[model samples]
Target chain A: MRRLGAALWFAVHTAGQNFRRNLGVSLAGVFTMGLILFLVGGALLFTHSVDSVLQAQQAKASRIKIYLSDSASLASIMDFQLRLKNDPRVISVTFENKDQAAREAAQNPDIQAALNALGSNPLPASLNLNVRQLTDLGQFDSMARNTPIVDKTTATDYNPDVIGKLRTVISVISLVGGIIALILLVISLVIIMNTIRTAVYARRTEIEIMKLVGATDWFVRWPFILEGVIGGLLAAVFSGGIVFLGYKLFVQAAQRSLLSVPFDASYSAALLFLLVLGGVAVGAFGSYLGVRRFLSV
Target chain B: MSVALAERPIMSPAPALRPVISFHGVTKVYPNGTTALRDVNLAVHQGDFCFLVGASGAGKSTLVRLLIREETASTGRIFIDGHEITRMPHRKLPKLRRKFGIVFQDYKLLNTRTVAQNVAFALQVTRPGQRHLREKVEEVLWIVGLEDKLDKYPDELSGGEQQRVAIARALVHRPRIFLADEPTGNLDPDTSWGIVQLLLQINHRGTTVLMATHNREVVDLVRRRVIAIEDGRVIRDEAQGSYLREGEATI
Candidate 1:
């Protein structure tokens, strides 16, 4: 028990002393790790916000309007609407009669002027659909084209060009974001390892003396590991605070701009927790590897 | 082999006393294929003081390293206090090292720490929370005649004073065996003699001492048991021998 207490004290005391004595190196390590963590957190939050924005945009864009022929029966159109609503891919099906369609078109000045010039209501009754996924739009478009109640000339307004472009944008953004995050994490680990290695190298004589005097490998290693953990924790706290603050400011800026990005409190909290956990783990593992080569002496 | 033995005066220890350190046909070949020690056999009993005299690369350091398990013998066995250390696991090295006090020509003192802290460091690392640590450090400093310089750092002291601080650190743990590898290599003649006298006092207190050195004057004046190494082989072993063989000049 006494030996254990003494060993703990020695580890703590030495860690603190070494940290203070090598303040330049220690701060360099912390600052580098802090910067990398900030980048990682910022990139992750950016990707998440972008994804949420794209999802909202996709919901708005994922719609198809199926126009009905003048000779089609009202009962046949109603049956088609019901069938479309029952399909799992469709979120909603709303019928727009000729009068309703005319009223909606009148809201646009160019279409309203054209309607005013016409002698009668020429707009056809149509079923507007909200779909669950972008790929289902093509299926709905083809299904509407084959229906007898649908207009042969204007089957459905499902623009494949717009949907294809949006799909490509979302995929590319996610892939780039994932790649950036992975690269940053790997770089942070390498930098932390090298920094800790430099610290270990500076005090190699102390380690040699300790080993020569019969100090156990663990006894020698504990101080360095503790120092690393302390450094990692400090970096994480500072960087996490900065990231959250930046996220808040970013959310505010985005809200003031054209985008309506919300502040995801739960996601931010989870991210902060992960940053802290990652910092500690990296620090400890880096220190362990740094001190390993010297123990053989 | 017979001619080599006949050329030098060889005196073995008394067989009745079990040796504190014994090497049975020990040989050390480093990774680069350099044989540092070749088929050497020797023993040192408890409370014995032996001088290891050799050239720079004559395997003196290798022998010292082998004794501390710093380097394992390529082929052979080493027994420390009757425990075979050749196959001892790495985990048990600390316990094995606790049995010996070792010093180097460089002193190996932490320049950042004061004399008291430097001595106390050994106890703190090995004994941990040992009682009366301050008193033990002070006593050991007094033993090396540096009780007054307790608060001084290594840089503040001269080479001899720094060496004394190193000695105090080694002595603080009260190890059973004291190994000094060229402990006086950097000191002046008078200071070297003083350090050797300190080792003598330590040995007088019944701790075994093995000193590896090229200092011929100290070995001759003290006239203690001497073992000389040449070409990675033990050339001579004497009970109370000088640095050179009888009627021979160079070593």
Candidate 2:
């Protein structure tokens, strides 16, 4: 246990010394990692916002309307509304009487002018329904159409074509964003590996001396590995801060433009944590690969 | 002053003599189809000072490399301290290496580290105690006469000082055998003499010294046991031997 502690201490000490000694190269590596992580974070935020926007628009279109028969009794229509309100799948159901429908149309100038030209009220009373799930719409439509009080069921205002296109757009955006993030991750790994390789090359003589002095392979490798991990962690903290501040500023700007952005602070914090953890893991892995080829002696 | 090969009988030490190193029919053939050593048989007893004298490409370095287990023998077995290291496992190689102190022609010292740290590095790797490391480093540096320049880096030191630091690093572990591969190869005559004298003093302290050198004057002056190699073959092995074959006259 004491031996392990000493080894760890030496590794940490040498890692710090190596970092300080090669400040310029280390900074370059960290900067590259930070930039890549920033791009990934931005992409994540963009995809998340777009996803929420599409969901909100889809929610608005998902509302289904059922037309009531002209001869249906008011008591039956009120009973139907009360039954739907108790249904688990139904979010809310509102009954619009013929007079109320005509009044709402009269509020619209174009509809009011058209109505003034038409002599009698042609619009029917209807029940507008909001469902918990989009899939529940078809079942609710069948249920409403079979009812004696409902004369006809109008197809949902939700356009399948527009929904399909929006879904495609979302998928394409996510796929493209994911690909870009993956490419950036690979780039960061290569940069970190090269940086560590250069550091190892610079200290090739030291490695030779260490081996000659009977230092175990781990003794020589741990310092470089630790240095790499430290570089990655530093980059994570830097990029995390940048992403946090950048996202906050973006949210503020979006609000100023009267655009509602679904920014979740806890989610963003989780993402930040993941980024840091990823940085540390990749840094250690890169360092391991970088020093592996050199430790044969 | 002179003795014939037949007249100068080979001193056959008692079988009870504990050998620090022994090579039985050792052969080394690199992957490039170059045979570095062939069917070599030799042994060095404890506290013996032996010089390996040969021209370039005569397998002197290869011998040292094999002894240190840097390169494995292509054939035959080698024993260090009665442990057969010819096929020693990779995991145990480091522990085996700690038993001998190896120096190189280049005086391999970490330029970024101070002189004291350079020496302390050897002990730090094998023995893991900070307090013990400092004391051992100080003791070894004092032995090499570099106690005052402990804080100085390699670049700030002269060739002799740097070589002394390398020696100190090698000696810090207090190995039973000291192996110097052309230790004076990079130094001037005066510097080389000083380094050779230091190795002699170290050998005098009862540590087995195995040095590979091309310096004929130093070899002749010391008149120690010399093993000469040519074309991967041990052509001569003599006690109180001179550097050159024809100059094998006792001092």
Q: Report how large a share of the reference interface contacts model 2 reproduces.
A: 0.56
lDDT (CA) per prediction: 0.92, 0.86
Number of clashing residue pairs, candidate 2: 0
Query: On residues A1-297, what C-alpha lDDT tens digit does candidate 2 reach at each position?
Result: 888888888889989998999999889888888888788877787777777777777687678888888889989989989998999988899988888989988999999999889988877898889888666777877787689877754422334466567667767888887888888888888987888888889888878777776778888899998898898899889988988888889888988998777778888988888889988988899999998888786
- Runs of candidate 2 with Cα error greater than 4 angstroms are A75-89, A115-120, A135-148, A153-157, B1-16, B247-251
Per-residue lDDT of model 1, residues B96-184, tens digit only? 99999999999999989999999998989888989999999999999999989999999999999999999999989999999999999
> Can you give the lDDT of residue A18 in candidate 2?
86
RMSD of 2: 6.2
Residue-level lDDT for A50 in candidate 1: 89
Model 1 chain B lDDT-worst window of ten: B6-15
Tell me, by lDDT, which candidate is best. Answer: 1
